[model samples]
Target: MSNELYTVIPDGSVTTPRGFRAGGLHCGLKKTGRNDLGAVVSDVPAAAAGVYTTNVFQAAPLHVTRESIGKEGKLQVMIVNSGNANACTGEQGMEDARSMRDAAARAFGVAPHLVGVTSTGVIGELLPMDKVLSGIERLPAAVSGTREGSEEFCQAILTTDLVKKEACVSLTVDGIEVHIAGAAKGSGMIHPNMATMLGFITTDAAIDAEALQSLLREATEVSFNMITVDGDTSTNDMVVAMANGLAGNEPLHPGHADWPRFAQAFVYICRELAKSIARDGEGATKLIEVQVEGAVSDEAARVIAKTVIGSSLVKSAAFGADANWGRIIAAIGRAGQPVNPDTVDIRIGEIVTLQQSRPVPFDEEQATEYLKGDTVEIHIHLHQGDGRATAWGCDLTYEYVRINAAYRT
Candidate 1:
């Protein structure tokens, strides 16, 4: 009923929420027999919302998914596959995306318009519908509203992701217990102005479709949109969420009394998942958090934070524990935001390396020691206003280059 509503279940996943079931299986999409096809279905019609990549050239599956969501605000299923992006394959690709949804709907006992489909991995490849449909036919039996079911689906959706990613939290609305959960995948091509990231969230809190869309956009601004793996955003970026009203809670809207608590928990899960994706950036060794504060406005702070975290120089320096403060300051200067040259300050962890735009006489050994840790925090203050923002990335290394160079080979 209040902001202090729910607790986090350590072993929770997308299926932790009520009314949801998920499963995945191998269908020869990947070179090996790893599960590459997956689906998540709700027991009832659920309100749905999606945010997608802003790239000029869109993917076929994205178009199909959009049509499904546009037909009705409610959805019951999402079919996803890894190893074949099905992007830019022309008209056949669009039909294949739609066909996958229809096949999945029939297999799951739902309407085709109530199903959405997404694909990831190699672009410009046509989806092998025969194998994908075969996988869908068997999904109903494998899918269940259990942790194992969610875990299997998680693996099926991954491409370069090193490990499964999921987050869940519990909350109460109108005295009714509600659960929210999410899962995502991205290891490279992840500069989320949306990312190559594909995120799916399921919840049992009855929320209005319009309200859900607004909430997702606002939360993404500070979560998914604040993460960077590399400078490139992928062709298949998307995050969709479904809310089934099985929790018996009062409907949530912008004006709902418990909307704040629900939104807080929702954003927390998104941020955790975002951080996880950043930490797992291809061949990354350490997580990097860039915090920008005291800017002229929140938007300015966000730009500065993102620019700093997305800097290759800064990332490489962190990888080597170089303690190169000049790279950090140079990044700030080139962020294209108005900053008082004499009012800037910077720090790595707790070690102050720059003060008021001047080099702070500091111990190189201390700075190197701080950067040697598994997580690095870069803090900057402009001393101009109260605005603040945080962005996440990872330490760039030689392994990153090696992995990406041979990514397709």
Candidate 2:
């Protein structure tokens, strides 16, 4: 997606931006020896923005992060942990979250409100503060502006995820070069309206908190909010972004001449991260994409696309390499959106399985072969209007049930 206005950094991460450093270390949270605690810090206060899970039972760390960022619209450091969600533990959970923030602030020599904290993992468990504070005390010593540090940070924030999700891009902002990078961790308990994921973005662009917040929300609607692995939403989903104004570009706003370019690059990074999460879904062997076109509105198209991608029948059919157009059309019909049944068309790859709302007699062998690939695309045309949308998910397999059935054990 790189072009004249922007370029992609092949090897980029959260620490790729100016004035930032990150690292991670083991904290006895996970059963394995992998690092379970991490922190990303900036040399100076940076403008901050965040979008959180809409679940009524929000996690404790989310409240702590929101309070810190809402205080002054800035943050100097973000502390995170995995393997313990610290949710449904009542007041004790909130105290532990704030304690995590205070410990990071004390270690980094920053004010408490300038530190943000978040956590993920098994719900209804109390965080072991002894291990967490010890990890925080040693966190700063591990911090550095290097790829190794970024990789450690990424590794520390995983549970069921098999691969690290990261993206970076650069765009020119008024003759100044600005870089944006992000890292995310998510595998299951994923669906629209956010998922069981934690995303962090860093940039060197000079932007205010208000403008950055608006841009983050808009980008999320088309990226993170359009993907699902399972139909369950989690309590700890959050995406936060920070800009340190180190790029030396003029302050950016919605009216800036190059704002659109920067936004494009930002949205691209976010979409890449979101797609990676979908591709790496728990026990998933293939990624499934649903593209809807010619709807009454973009929102309607999005609804139809999500419905198709989230259908268990559709996912199972893809997993079995079956060209089941019936499941696809069934999902579209139940999406509760406007659609002209007589003018509908559906295709699996280049093979048209249905046209004008009727069977088209496609090659079963060819269609099955296409579905067996690592990625599959389902194209649907409503022929009702100019609206369009794309959604991503993954094929369901027996392995998925096996993994989740004994996850807590």
Candidate 3:
């Protein structure tokens, strides 16, 4: 959609922004021979901000990445590998993550501190440095500042994700078209802990490091932090963002006249990517959207919405196309959020199954037809206040258990 504010561009990724180049290749880390290694580099150092998983046992690469961002708030390249999480290998894992950073710096001709590294899959295993370093060396040659290169990078980062997740939008900044885009990879072990998964976003707008960080944090609170998959947080969740001054726009700040426009576009990209991750969750057959409104407060609404979406019973009901509204009501009550028990309303799709906290007659055939779609909506109105929030998740299916049961296989 194009308008005076922002326009959505299809098939966009990190490389859609000016000065960024990216690609990936199979590096033997994955037995399937699919691409498992990828890198993204900016022609010049970019303003950087990163949000990491809140799991107590953090992954090794997260430390190096956090240090890189904290030290200079700038990044030129990011080295990423799938198939090995580089977590719980103790000191050696930290060392390997650092070595990956250095190897990538050498490959991209950037300082070590300017590189950020991340990994996923098979935690508790050390990275195969020989293969990873070799991939790094090949990464520079494979990476191009083209859309195809962006798609390659996208494919390289996936683990159990069934489909690629990418979003892009362009807006006029200082009369110049500035692009903001993002891609993410997540399926299992996903729950909102600051950021629920691994995501990379790039923009061509000239924004201060502090301003960009502020926007990222604010946007993530309502976007990535509102999604859930399996209700388990990962040890390596991170969302890193880079902004290069290639768009030739004046420096942007909190009070900048066009800051809201840029912020909205950035958040839209993040939200779309979040929804895609939820839709593509392991063994997920349908995306579920939970909307909670008329709560006592926005925070209360958020907690209720997330609880409803994260409920296994609710997810199972959605998967089976069952109009069992009791599970949702139970989730809301146990969410610890203040709610008027006598004034609650719940609906599945267009069928209002609960009115005034009581059961309402609904057609089972219509509910089954609605839930059969690829996406489902569960709406709740507390009739308490104007507070509102929305969270996303996927229906729990038998295939989910099967996938995880043999995950290591």
Candidate 4:
């Protein structure tokens, strides 16, 4: 949690890490001329770890990625396409996903088992393989080990997102400078069980595949898994991480001396990316953060925090700049977490609207003004234990409705 161990790289991206190159291109996946296909290629086989959506109708690309990474716990190239979610297309979809993987392998000169693939956009439709394969053929030429390449790749993964989400940091591990960077995109259908949307993390640290997998899973629990937008988990949500071990440091694990610093930086990057996704929620005007403390356990606190932040009533209230403590309390109650009603406290910014579950008359105008800001913070104290957690969301607004009403068109 301390900033002393790492430095934030200004305008950093996936290519910021050593031995990584990224790029994106337009392949006619979308009606507009925006880049719809992208790739992040590691110079060598990199230890890989991934977490995918829990939605039953998982995308075909997710299965392909899992097979590639599960074989040897490493990946050399990761291909992604936007504007087509490659889900629910039956056996043809499976074949298409493998075809994409094969194309990426051939283009990048890597084994098919060393390449992973992902897709996002419209669901339940077959991908236009003609265009997708053409994009894959030209993909290698588009890639470069530069910031511009990373930027382009980020842009290509976006669907309804208004802005790209990325985070990068450098920390010293075993006296070697290690860099870690991530890029993500998600504006809607973002309630995550493991992870939301398409996220990619690249690091140059020397970490074992098992250790990296464990660390990434832990980070997702408190970061991506804690945020919600519309409470609809997509069919093609996943976060994939590759560690190229180009830092030339000692192998990292739980017992490594600098593991704490590395883990801290990793979790920080994920949380920042997740918060960006929440802030950029489809047509959202304001970012709302809910902090729940003193629950029976950390899991309980997480559930309560997510419940409060995900509630439509709470989001609507935030959009209207209303000090609606009742909605917050109602959410907390339904969270199914143990809460001593009489000892619960609630606050919107510094305005205390509820104290020990008793109404505290506060200046409604001040509360409204605070909620009207670009960011809102809600604090709930249960006085039950030491467990605490935080969740992020965005206010419900008319623009959100208008954007989703005709999203497919």
True lDDT of residue 128, candidate 1: 82
Instruction: List TM-score per model, in order.
Output: 0.98, 0.99, 0.98, 0.99
Which regions of candidate 3 are displaced past 4 Å? 194-196
- Model 4: pairs clashing at backbone N, Cα or C within 3 Å: none
Model 2 ranges with Cα > 4 A deviation: none
Report the Cα lDDT for candidate 3.
0.91
Tens-digit per-residue lDDT, 239-312, candidate 4: 99999999999999999999999999999999999999999998899999999999999999999999999999
lDDT score of residue 320 within candidate 2: 100
Please list the C-alpha lDDT of all candidates, in the order they appear.
0.90, 0.94, 0.91, 0.94
The TM-score, computed over Cα atoms with residue i paired to residue i, of candidate 2 is: 0.99
lDDT of 3 at 34: 88
Candidate 2 residues 98-195, lDDT tens each? Answer: 99999999999999999999999999999989999999999999889999999999999999999999999988898988999999999999998899
Model 1, poorest ten-residue lDDT window? 1-10
